[model samples]
Target: MRVDIWSDIVCPWCYIGKARFERALASFEHADEVEVEFHSFQLDPSAPEEPEPLLSFLADRYGMSTDQARETDAGAGANAEGEGLAYTSARKNANTFDAHRLLHLARERGRQREAVDTLFRANFGEGADVFGREALVGLAEKAGLDADEARRVLEEGRYADHVKADVEQARALGATGVPFFVIDERYGVSGAQPADVFTRVLEKAWEERD
Candidate 1:
């Protein structure tokens, strides 16, 4: 079984969905046969590389007051914790192009899953700035990737097309949000659905294959 997940680094639901999916995989009898691939999807394609503070960005975009933003943040933080991700004050959204590049490198090294997990932890758990080149290189290094090679790729604007292509493919596949999962490239499951939902889908796919 193959699962291709389209998600963003800063997406709270993606993190939660990841955890849920992991749990589902663990519970599945044929876990060892499952292959998971993480694909890139930017929440704000037009967002600047260095945007304003997340609160301000949300406030302006949604026309919400600062207080409302803060309240929402608190609620999101609690939800993130429930999903096993720690949320801190250091959280901010940065341009994820470089982060996506690092992910591409991880795929080359056959460590894409680890890279994705590290990226999510850095952005949501530790509140690291994922959009910065240095931060992205650092995360790649932590995930056992070659830091120098990662930097070179980012500096040279490599894999930008791959990221864009992935986004376009997701759109063509009718994915409108992050945490979108395509099972066996035929079944689509959106959002951070419950583990039971994922388990049921996986079982159905496996049964159909057999």
Candidate 2:
């Protein structure tokens, strides 16, 4: 069984949804047989590489005030906390293309899952500036990737096409948002659905797989 997840590191729901899906996978009878991979998806492709206040970005994008955006983040924070994940309000938002490129490198190194987890934690949990290059290299090192290689990849723009291809694939699959899950290319689950939903789908996919 293969589970390909399309999610952005900066997306709160993607962080929460990953936890939920893992919870389901943890308890699945065929857990050891499941091969899970994370694919890159950018919620804001045109976002600046330099960091900006996430709340302000949200406020401008949704035509809401900063206070309203904070309230919305609070709700998302609460949901993340429900899943035993940390969520801080002072998060930054920016272009994640380089991060996605690094993910492809991590995948080749067999540390893709760890890299994804580390990036999510750095952005949403520790409130680290994941948008910055040095910060990203630190996070990659924390995920057990070689720091020098990670830095080189970022500098040289390695795996850039892989990142773009992943985004294009997401579009071809009709995914208009992050946290999209495609199970065996058979079932598509969107957003932060509950763990039971993931469990049921996992089981169904397992049963129906040829």
Candidate 3:
């Protein structure tokens, strides 16, 4: 079985949802037979390249006060801690197009999953500036991708088409949000559902596959 996950690195729910799904996948009976792929989806395509405080962005975008935005982020952070993952709200928000491009390069090198995890950690855990080119190369290196090649990919704008294609495909699949999971191309699960829900879906997909 193959699972294609569409998500953005900056999305807190995607970070939390990934942890939940992995908990299910790890305990799955046929875990070794499953193939998982990560697809890119930019939550804010028109977000500024220059970084800004996430709390301010959330406040301005949603008509909430900065304090209210922090409260909302705190709620999400609490959820992440429940999943045993670190969540920091003191991060900057910026365009993730280059980060997604770097991930495609990681995919070519058989390190996409690792890269995805690393990016999430950089964004939400350590509160690193993941949107910059230098930061991405460093994160890619941490994910076991070749540092020089990763730099070259980012510098030359490689895998841009692949990133754009992922977004287009997600649209074709009727995905309007991040963390959308398609299991065996037959089951679509939206949102950060509970672990039991994912386990049941995986089992059903496994049983029903030809």
Candidate 4:
């Protein structure tokens, strides 16, 4: 089975959804037969190139106080802890175009999953900027990709079209939000659903495969 997941690195729910999906896959009987791919979806494509505090962005966008935004983020962090993920919610929201481009490069190197995990960790678990070129290079290396190659990919803007195409496809598929999952190109699972939901869907898709 092939599972293509469209998610943004800055998306909190997407990170949580990944953990839930992993748990479901771990319990799947045919886990070894499954291939997971991550695609690009920007929650805020026009996010500033210069860094800004995540709390300020949240408060300004949602018309909430900074404390209220922090409270909301803390609640999400607690949920991430349930999945054994260390989420800190103290990072800045960045333009993820280059990060998405790196993921495409990682895919060619057969390290897409690793790249996805690293990006999520950088933006969520640790207070790292996924948009910074140096930071992206470090994450690429951490994902088993060549650091120099990763730098070139970002510096030269490689795989940019692939990132755009992924976002376009997500829109065409009626995905209005991040963390959309497509299984076997036939089954579409949306949002950060429960692990059991993913498990049952995985089984159903595997069985329906012809």
- For this target, which candidate reaches the highest lDDT against the unseen true structure? 3
Per-candidate TM equals 0.95, 0.98, 0.98, 0.97
The residue pairs found clashing in candidate 3 are none
RMSD of each: 1.3, 0.8, 0.7, 1.0
Scored against the true structure, residue 200 in model 2 reaches a CA lDDT of 98
User: Would you list the rank order by lDDT, best first?
Assistant: 3, 2, 4, 1
Q: Which stretches of candidate 2 lie over 4 Å from their true place?
A: none
Predictions in order: lDDT: 0.87, 0.93, 0.94, 0.92
Tens-place lDDT per residue, model 2, 1-210, is 999999999999999999999999999999999999999999989998988899998998899999999999999999999999989989888999999999999999999999998999989998898878899899999999999999999999899899889999999999999899999888999998999999999999999987
Q: Model 4 over residues 63-162: C-alpha lDDT tens digits?
A: 9999999999999898899989888867898688888999999999999988998888888989788888998899899999999999999999889999
Model 4 vs. true fold: TM: 0.97
Whole-model lDDT, candidate 3? Answer: 0.94
**Model 1 misses residue 131 by how many Å?**
1.4
Clashes of each: 0, 0, 0, 0
* Model 1 Cα lDDT, one tens digit per residue, 27-129: 9998999999999999987777984677777788899997888787887687778876777645786667778877988998998988998988888788777
Clashing pairs in 4: none
lDDT for 66 in candidate 1 is 77
The residue pairs in collision within model 2 are none
Number of colliding residue pairs in model 3: 0
Error of 4 at 103 (Å): 0.6
Candidates by TM-score, descending order: 3, 2, 4, 1
